[model samples]
Target: MKTEDEWQHCLTPEQYDILRKKGTEAPFTGKLLHNKEKGKYICAACGMELFSSEAKFDSGTGWPSFFDANKENIATKRDLNHGMIRTEVLCKHCSSHLGHVFEDGPNPTGLRYCINSASLDFRK
Candidate 1:
């Protein structure tokens, strides 16, 4: 595990704010929102594989949406912030905030993992 100082030093300001501080990137502004490449999305802080390109879909919600994730590398918990109750996703390996997951998604899993691009790095 890396110290907070180490994370700050290694990550960009946007990555630190979104991954470490649980901050959300502006909707429709994430770099991966329109990405259709075949690859895996890994945690920016820990390099843990989180999502596969096969699971990605355009949810029209402005964030990178996935129908499935690398379950072993991710975790979720109740989030009651901003006057709403939601499930917040995290990178289990490093405990970095990734984003949230919702039930309103396509068939097969019916899960929409609305993630922040700053919290992830793509590996093709």
Candidate 2:
């Protein structure tokens, strides 16, 4: 876990907000929202491998959507924020917020990992 100071120093305000403070960026504004490259999406905070390019798909949700993730690199918990119940996905190593996973998704895993681009670093 990173101290508040460490997080502040390493992350930009936007990155810290989404990754540490659990905030969401506006839809359709994410850098990786339309990314079609072949690479891995890694945690911006800790460089942990989270999702593979092969698992990515255009869900049209304006976020970087993936049907599946590197399951072992992620951890989830029940979140009851905004008067709604959702499963919050976080980086397993750093516990930084990535986004939420939902059941409404494509084939294979049938899960949608709607992640914030600010929370990720794409390597192609």
Model 1 C-alpha lDDT per residue in residues 60-98, reported as the tens digit of each score: 888999999999999999999999999999999999999
Per candidate, the number of residue pairs that clash is 0, 0
RMSD of 2: 0.7
Stretch of 10 with least lDDT, candidate 1:
28-37
Tens digit of per-residue lDDT, candidate 2, span 32-116: 9888889999999999999999999999888999999999999999999999999999999999999999999999888999999
In terms of TM-score, how similar is model 1 to the real structure? 0.98
Off by over 4 Å in 2: none
